[model samples]
Target: MEERQKIKVGISIGDLNGIGCEVVLKTFEDSRMLDFCTPIIFASNKTISYQKSELGLEINYNGIQEASKALEGKINVVNVWREIPAINFGEATKEGGDYAIKSLKAAVTALKNGEVDVLVTAPINKNNIQAEDFKFPGHTDYLAQELEGESLMFMVTDELKVGLLTDHIAVKDVAQAITPELIKSKVATIEKSLKIDFGISKPKIALLGINPHSGDNGIIGQEDDAILKPVIKEISESGTLVYGPYSADSFFGSDGFKKFDAILAAYHDQGLIPFKTLSFGKGVNYTAGLNKVRTSPDHGTAYEIAGKGKADHSSFKEAVFTAIEIFRNREEFTELTANPLKKSRLKREFR
Candidate 1:
């Protein structure tokens, strides 16, 4: 494993028309960030220069053709594309989507090839990013297929952590998606991620009910009692410390969420609404349960404030810091757990 300070972070430049470049520039503008990790941005020099000119922020970045050549204590820009697409801030354009995918693909390739240590993605307009090559709903879906594990959209802050069982789905379809298999799978994913990524052992997890009031004992809906309750009990009995089927409405509002290490919600909005409300600018959208680490800002491409110099870079900065932290945590975890069983067996044989 590389040294903690030598972690190379690969960044995918998201929608050119949005605030991706703006916040990215703002993040690395502070030289102190370089002390932790080396950053390699996947975009053309022309695009970064133009964004710099627009934001009127002065920063220096080294130009590199590949992520392997990234320099320490300096921001590196990899030229994924030479032709500069038209930047239409405050608007979603096809070109913006096109370039966003290009950057993401390049960064993913580097990640798989071990050119970079971890990846921090910028927000993309999901509607505009639809194409044959990229048909998934969001980053989690795409990364799940490309990476090695089942991905969970975990929104996290220092005080709270919330993961979704089903993300980027319509409200009407959420109930049916909450099956026993899915519940177990998400629980396992969140549990493993908590142990390895966040370094939490014996993690206590809470699950929000799919139906309101947890189905009110089948008065409102049967899914919660018929499905969630039984499955959660089964998991808890297996020594995981899992519990729930709690009413979603009162869980966060009543401070019930503070009791656990993490909470798993049934669907997208149920988990995100409270998370954003409580920790919007400070939260990071971490794609947990993957082999490699990836994180993004909780906020999206704020087209309304795009290119106006009013965009807040706090979430993006947190995303970068979180990615670096998780990368180091994973390495440390691997070292500590490596060959434990083998050593145990060897001791018995020697005795």
Candidate 2:
């Protein structure tokens, strides 16, 4: 088999004062990671040096101005911002968020220009990152608008995959957002992602109910029966293997989610709460249905743990690996889909 070319992975330092630097540095400490892909971190050398000193890490990164100049066998750092911001750890400052957006903006520009093959982002403070440049709720929403593609906030672990139907919306507004059209679109995105990004040819999906006990047969709410049931039925009739508006409370407790390839949650907390409870530091938040690759650690910027050198880099490392795997899977899928006649003829032969 021919060896594939190394992919260039872009890194965005989330909140400068947060544990983003810690995890990013810890993850790249093992130089062997360079063999798989070239990592171009969109953070200043000053920031990285400060983090290394604070964490007492001896890891070294090659500083480069351009992502294209990133070298193999070494970690690369790009100075997104030249000015040194005050390093106030554990505090939610506007300066932290400003530099975080700067790093993200530069890395995103590189991603768009094909300077990077995939992007693995560290955690950011949503509140502080909220400004004129970044008015969106979070990275997924921002990336969706920037890339002109619909994004599904898909959380992935070894055992389970959960995709949110309505992301960053309030609990009170979730019921109103649970429409048939939204359900169908999100489920379709999940289906496509499973096939192309995950290499799952025929994905079995379970949709969690919006209300308690699946609306208790319309006693508590009507969305589960009226909207969810009809939509799942329609999607199933279209040859998709989707089932259930399963009650959220008992679904995971009964291990019901293990039966399907992925679960589509009605809203953010409905799916993410259970997912985080089950997986915690093991999950990767994958932005599915996008034309480009983007993944982040399931957890947030751990302000309490920032600068303590206690931050777990497991999820961040997993995010990088997952991004690479998904990118490879997408490439293979594109090649496989490029020849329709060949696929049709092969299907006839198998039949």
Candidate 3:
């Protein structure tokens, strides 16, 4: 049999105190992961060892300094930190937060240098990580600055994909951020992401309104009519399939969302509330429009249920599967785009 193609995937261990380690370890217990890609975990040897001992998992850990040292049947651990404090499950400490950031930075560096095909991050604590040096809201903003690309946070499930225009901002401040340029830029990023990362030829996007009943035609608010409508119109004219400023409240009820491949919300909660409501445990949070592919489980650190082997690895498992699929699709897209004959054959097969 032909050797299975190997794609290098970098993983950043999120808060050591949380279920990040538990889920990550549990997810990799399956040997089948080697069939898709080589997983490179950016974390300390001690941290992983502690988790393995605590969880009573028999997973093998291979310490390596470089990506090329990865071997099949062993989980490669790139020791980014030398000494990590003893972890207290369900507790968030500054040390754990700093360690999480360190892991993330190492993985990102590997990604930018072409050492990895994709990046799958574990969850980190937003509040615990807040400090003088770590000022960014979350991974989205931090990755955006590092990659110098406009990033969009999109939650993915088998049934729906939802993108947020403004994330981690206060609800009161959402209106101020809803300029036409911002909407246009975010939508364009989402469109490009769908086409390039997801291999969608023609993406259908649904845009959600800022107010109830789509601003009730200017009675509730004029931001939809003034900002969103013009932006959507301009994008549509540019040959991108986009519609809406659909009422946020009614969009989920009407099967109106099913018509489009993805939905763009005006702000954070507008998109996430319904998305999390429907896809809390099973959804995967994907950071789109980045130079490298990054995905995480949709749920948070879940400190309340950190240890005890009760954490579900389904989302993390889905995240790994999603990363591999995206990586393969991107490779296929790149190859086909370079060869017209292959592209034509693919189109014919789909048709």
Candidate 4:
């Protein structure tokens, strides 16, 4: 395999009171991770030092004032703020939330400015992170607004990928939101992401029904039969093939999800509940269809395990690696698609 350029990974430290810092530090403690990318952590050195002492860790890292000064083969900590805020483990406080936002905003700004190749964020307390400047449901919505593009909350792993049609909305409103236009738009974004980000040439997508048993052929509910099924048929005939309004209940139970490249669910709990159950420790939440690449762990802050030295870093580690791979895949796909003659010539030469 050809050696690729080292990508800069901008990381955000989530709630100080939770296990964000623990997982970030633990994920990069092995030192071998620096070979693939230069990690620039978006938090103050004082905060990292405090967390390191509390967690009894002795990891090597470098502190820098800017992302541009980050060194290769080093864990660079970009000091977002000089003063360290008060730490309260296993609790949510206004101070911790404020600090978390500062780190997040700084990293996002760097990402937008092209200072970093990808962003890997730790978990944040959604309730406490809410404020005047940040009024969105979560990172996916917030980043979508910031980047001025739609983002699909794609849950990814080695086995299967699941995306939500209606995210962070009430169950009753979910049915109304599943219009034919919305389904087509979301499916298009998912298909593009599957090709560019996952390197799938022709992706197969399956949509789960909004109602129980896919509305039992419109006997249980009319939305599935009226809105979803028709949209799937129209999209399939248009060149990009897609399947389903499959019963969400039996799809995963019978391993039907494995047949498709990606699965699109009607609502949040409908998709995430099953995804988490299957790929909890290894799944990555990829914000697809954006100009920038961002990934987060499948789990939350885990406030109960904060500062206990027991937080697992598997998902966080996977998030970083997934971001790197997606960035590379996007570059590769763009290069191939930029010129048709070159692709044809290369294929003919190989043959």
Candidate 5:
């Protein structure tokens, strides 16, 4: 097999009070990981050393002033802060939130400047990571502002791919939020992502209904029949193959989810609940439709296990690998698109 050029992966240290640093350190502990990509951690070396001392983890890394200084075959730490802040495990402190933003902004700037090829962020406390400069719900919204294209939260694994029609919104507001324009935009973004990012030439997407039993043909509620059905019909007729407004209740349980390339859920919990259940805590939260690649673990900061050294790094590892893979896929897609005749066999599905 030919050795591919190592991708420069920018890492953000999320919620210092939580297990963000723990999982990140653990993921890169094995030196063999360097064979795939050069990692530039966007946090002070002091911060990482503190976490390592508490957790008893060790890994050799290079400390650099910027992402451009990162070297292949070594882990690089880009000092985003000068002072070593307090480390209060299992607590959400104001310092934690502020530092998380600092790391994030630095990494994003690196991405924008093309110093880093892709990004894999650790978990951040949504409630605490809110302030004047960063008032968005989570990473997706923040990245949408910093990067190009409409951001869609796509939780994915090998077998199942789930996306949200509405993420990080209240259930009460969901009904009003699910408009025809919104559905078309989200679907179009997801479809484009499927083809370019996942390398699926002809993608088929499934849409889960909003109400119970998909409104039971308007017997329960009219949102599914009145809003979702008409929009789906119009989109399908316009040429992108689509299915559903399928009853959300039986879609995953009946194995109906596996039949399509992707599943679009009506809201946050509607999509994520089933996705987490099916993925078994190994899913990667990919920010689709962005010009630059960014992904993170589906699970948030595990505060309870923050300093216990028991935080499972599987999801975090997958996040890193997924971002790297998507970067390669986009390159392949571009190459294939340039050669129109060879586009027929572009690449395999995300699964």
Candidate 6:
């Protein structure tokens, strides 16, 4: 049997007042998590302890000064903040927001330095964290700025994968944001990521329309025909298999989504509504086209369900597994990239 190469996964504790701690503790409690990677959580020791006690969870955490000393088969923790006041389960406080941001920064730093192979983030409250220092709408935007890449927010399940062209923007502003350049860049990013991160050589992608019934051939609206059509044509001509500007209403029911590897929705609600309905508790949010691979559970911080021991850990577990798979694939791809013979052979085969 081949030895399993252990991936070092860095976890950011999201809003401490939410179910982030509960899910993290629950996910790591399983011994199977140790099989693929060593988990390192960026959070305060006290906060973790409080959550474990509150939830009656029996997971052991090993505190480490640095990521380098993380031990195999143990949940290594890098403490960030301490002495936070006890949190009300459903309430968002300024302190909780600050702490969550601190943890996220620490994890990002570790990833930038190559201390971790992949990053699995817990949920954070966007409203609470939207202060002067934290101006980004959500993780996707912040990560895009920090990593300096064309990032797309993609939600993935076993059956469906949805990518967003514009996220966390007003419905009124969505149309103006959908430019040809933005659409082309997002489609290209999704194409490259599907090949590198998801290990698909030729990925088929579907683009959803911005208007009803795909704008009824320009009677309802013309953005789909004007902006999206040209971008789709350009990408298709370049040898990438992309389809659509399909009507958002009928796209999911026609089994239209099943034919493609991923769907590119024009805006947030267009993509997320169907995805969340189909994959409520099972989907993983992956930020594609970053220098480092990052994934988070699809759902946000469920403050109402925090510390009740009612939070589901399935998504978090899936996130860990997804990160491990991506890390392995990336390592293999990197090796192939470094070998000229393998690279040439691959290029010849594709050609």
lDDT of 3 by residue, 41-93 (tens): 99978888889999888898899887667776678999887886768899999
Best by TM-score: 5
lDDT score, candidate 4, position 219:
93
Question: Which of the numbered candidates is closest to the native, going by highest lDDT?
Answer: 5
Candidate 5, residues 49-81: lDDT per residue as tens digits?
889989999787888888899989998999888
- Off by more than 4 A, model 5: 1-4, 340-351
Q: What tens-digit string does per-residue lDDT give for candidate 4 at 91-174? A: 999888888889999999999999999999999888898899988778888899878567899999979899999898889899
How many clashes in each structure?
A: 0, 0, 0, 0, 0, 0
Candidate 1 residues lying further than 4 Å off, grouped into runs, are 1-5, 339-351
Candidate 5 lDDT score relative to the true structure: 0.90
What's the TM for model 6? 0.94
Runs of candidate 2 with Cα error greater than 4 angstroms are: 339-351
Work out candidate 1's RMSD over C-alphas: 5.9
Model 2 lDDT, full chain set:
0.89
Q: Residue 136: error of model 1 in Å?
A: 1.4
- Candidate 1, residue 277: CA error in Å? 0.3
Candidate 6 per-residue lDDT, tens place, 1-351, comes to 686658899999999889998999999887767776899999867878888999999989898877777898999999776566667777899878888898899999999888888899999998888778789888889999889688999898768889999999999999999998898899999988888887788999999999998888899999988888888898899999999889999999788899999999999999999999989888999998888889999898988788789999989888887777777777667877787355311111110
Write down the TM-score of every candidate.
Answer: 0.95, 0.95, 0.94, 0.95, 0.96, 0.94
Candidate 1: tens digits of C-alpha lDDT, residues 1-351: 664357798999899989999999999888888877799999999999999989998899999898888889999999998886899899999889989999999999999999998999999999999998899787888999999988889999879999999999899999988899999999999999889888888899999999889989999999998899999999998999898889999899999998999999999999999999999899999999899999999988999989988889999989988887788777767777984443111011110
Q: Where does candidate 1 have its weakest 10-residue lDDT segment?
A: 342-351
Better of 4 and 6 by lDDT: 4
Q: What is the per-residue lDDT of model 2 for residues 1-351, given as tens digits with 9 covering 90 to 100?
A: 686678899999999889999999998888767777799999888989988999988898899988989887789999777877898889999999988899998999999999999999998999999897689888998899877567999999869999999999888899898788898899999999999898889999999988899999999988889999999999999999999989999999999999999999988888999999999988999999999999999999889989999999989988988888888878777777885343211111110
